[model samples]
Target: MRIPNLWVNVFIIFVLPNLSNGQQLSTKPLKLTDGQNGVKSIPYRATDQCMPKMDAKRGKTTYGLSFRLHSKGGHCDDGLLICYPGMLNRHADSLGFKVKGLFQIDNKKDNKVNQFCSFKMQKEGISAGQTHWRGIKVYTMPNGTENRQTMLEASVASRPYKLGTNVGQFSIHLGGNGTDLLTMITVNDGKAFIDNQANLQKQFLEQFWNGAFLREHTGLWMLGLDLLPSMKQENVKLFIARNCNCTMETWFTQPTDSSDPKEPELPTAGSNNCSIEFESTSEATTNKNDVSDECFGEKHFEIRFKNIFKKCWMKFANACPNQTELIMLTMSRRNGFENRMGIRQTWMNDSVPGEVIRFLIADAEDGEANDVQQKLEEEQAKHGDLVFLHGFVDIYAHLHLKVYGGFKWQQSFCANANWVLKVDDDALVHLRRLAYWTGKKFRPIVAQNPLVFFGKLYHKYLPIRNPKSKWYASKEMYPKDMYPDFMQGTVYLTTPATINAILLHSGQIDAFYLEDVVYTGILAELANVTLSDQKKHFKWRFDHFDEKNGECEDGVPTPFSIWGAEKLNVFEHQYGRMKSIECKK
Candidate 1:
């Protein structure tokens, strides 16, 4: 089912409660000018004092109050905790919050998130004294007001939080049965953990205030995490709010905001400047599974690459095991730091594809710039070989491609290839099978519905979540009911000539964030190339299907792509066992 996009907000409140030894004293609430000397504070012993109607109805053993700061001006230019009648809590040493899941928040929207602050409180009981409020310090704001936002009705339950070692340990894993969002974090003085509802409302509210918004709104976005154990904290204090001007264009309609009513609608299908077809070797290579294109150039460039590589390899005095080479290139210097290390080690190892050649154009010769150069140079010397270009020469869209422009760097290296496969560093390649499969054919392996697996299928998004996700391409951005079958840029294959054509044609195409989707899917759409899916390219849940015919969960593993390394290792062990038995024959 095709899911529609929607919007939501998030907030993160970390509270530290110290009610150990004995009951503590309640600190005097800071006076506000709303016609009150001191604010009426709710003690920790009170049950259901703060009602935050959470999407998830789960919590802990004990309960307490914590108050999240609502910046008076809608934006938190000044760090202050203006108290209202919510739960009271304190911010731990590591005062940073992180959000991760199927939902993504754009950190670029608003920068005021860096200035907001909050407080921590412990639960009150019959035996628990007012002294319990001692460790709970009340931090006053320098320049902020209290009545900015309202507290929502939510769930009630308390659990111990680990504020020291496990304070910053935060992770959110999405995808599960029904619509439940689950979270697990370390708590209880490092002795145990708690699985409860992670204030997703608060998460979205923070994102909303910071200018980050959600995209899909059909299903509910769930969060599961273990609380940091230290004080008695409740789930009801969680809430989300946004002060930025809301816009449909900012959420899902447009890439950038504009008042032009004549603005073009999002393209559902068609090719653009960023799309191209690589050399396919033969008409059959391009015709596999009904994938066809006129702009791709009917002339297959496979033989030309084989002919060129035959000479280059011979000249270099190096020979690939079966004349199959995996040519990899990196364009941006920033990507070299963000993901290159993991990419090279996980996907470029010898057991996967034959060889992975990394090409970089060093912009500077010294300083930290040189350090990046030095690090990459050292990595190449240690892991494999590096190709360094002297200065600024734009072979591809260096500025726009960011992390996805690596394939554009393979132009000169196209000579040594039976097939050329382009993939991003973040993708975990299944090298062995990919190499073996590419050796058997020259046609591209595309998906029937690209990004669908990550969208409505395996990892689906709900409508109430943040609407500012990158995946929410509207009709103005895409025109078709669904994406044409195209190779995921994370991993796509072509003939050597096709690679060269793509390299040359890449100039006509403007660079995009996810280059693979832009080129193989969007660009191919315009070029009239029919994208076909190689069923084994993606993974389905084991229980979601009835049988496992040695399909390796998703499909065959390519040494160049990312697969579950542990699972792959287990398979390799089993393969070794089977191979030994076959050798006995």
Candidate 2:
């Protein structure tokens, strides 16, 4: 099943009860006015009160009150609570009616019957006499000064509970059958005021209110809540409000606001630059089972390369008991016979005693390219060095598939090799110097590091957009502004473990046209492999080969691997100049 690209938002709400250690419900009518508008707010009265002390085991308890508000003729605005710190032993009448607006009571549904008020202490450095109170008020105007019965008020004073630790941050972890949720809250130096409804539904509500202190930290809190089992398959919405200095600064509801920075930003529908087109012919449909079995089965190929390698091992067992330390995988085309021969005559023949070289080719499509397929089969039969990926097409766009198959082949047959170098058939390699460098310089690092990937590195490269260009990549193919760090495809080196990692992560990434970008850049990033720059070891174009110059100094420490070197004479000249020079230690 295709995964949908969606964004999610999450919030963390902390509820701190009043330090007086109790709850309260009041019905006495209290008048409040908006300082900005200078108009009387909603008519609400506190009905009940409870001041439960903080528990010794539990660090802090809550104090709250319930309210009964008179229904107005028109719609009622939301309620607000202004808190006064260090107001212990001061009743509502003795407090002198001066309170800083701290908490907001959001009556989004506009329910008119009852409202709740609660407050918690967030200040850590408060003295023993220092107490806090919540002055409750609503946002509705009085109804033409109508005379009504006085609202009944009740206040219950309970025994104080022991106070708990007053830390700056608190965290809670909830684990279920599936994913776990972590919630945390932190305040600077002042007290935190929480509402009564938040206290009641502390397990379910995920909201946060502005605290007393600011300016030091970002007030940044993170919460991860697991979705209900029933809601796991459905979309979820979250509301977020950022209030600055007791005023709502921003209120937004979005589907994709997550507090986790590590969460990968998926491509949204609006930002999707690539579209997938799937074409299935009758031949492909008929061979669907076979293809699936070949690709995903226990064996990844119909014709395995291990048998040929085993035969070669038996033939060379007397001469060399140990397997080759390095294997050069030269990607070749089905019809590039002369290019393969030129490579064999040049660097392939110049390989040291323990090193091995092989060519990789894929089978042609059904009912086409029969001549090229026949020639490939003949070449494979004669040399046994051609690793043919049966039931796969040899196309430029499917180079990733070829490389994947090669990785599987190496894992199966040449698992003991220290390093695997991939190059093109048209390129010439200075294998001797490469061998020297790998043995003398790179071996110690590779011995301690198995995840090292080395080649000519490219970073922040834009995709080719011209349709006529050979490397043109449409926006639909790649949407990012720059490709991830990747080694150039022409020449790159990987160890057995790195190859395994690349193969393991290949399925997680979308298949792209460029093999290097897909495998080395995308899959390598996912696999977390280390990529090193090897520009000194490989060059793209060898148009300027000067033996008298530093290019060939000390036996050409850098291998001259050039593109468009299909001519045998070019390889002969290049190899003749490079063969005699040995890298000076």
lDDT of 2 by residue, 167-241 (tens): 211111111111112222222232332223223223222222323211111111111221111111122121111
Candidate 1 C-alpha lDDT tens digits along 486-539: 454444554444443344444344333334555565455454444444545433
Kindly give the stretch of ten consecutive residues in candidate 1 with the minimal lDDT sum. Answer: 306-315
TM-score per candidate, in order? 0.33, 0.45
Q: 84 in model 1: Cα distance from truth in Å?
A: 43
Q: What is residue 556's positional error in candidate 1, in angstroms?
A: 8.5
The residue ranges of model 2 lying beyond 4 angstroms of the native Cα positions read 1-322, 365-370, 552-556, 580-585
RMSD versus native structure for model 1: 23.1
Tell me, by lDDT, which candidate is best. Answer: 2
**Local accuracy by lDDT, each model:** 0.29, 0.43
Score residue 457 of candidate 1 by CA lDDT: 16
Query: Global lDDT for candidate 1?
Result: 0.29
235 in model 2: Cα distance from truth in Å? 55
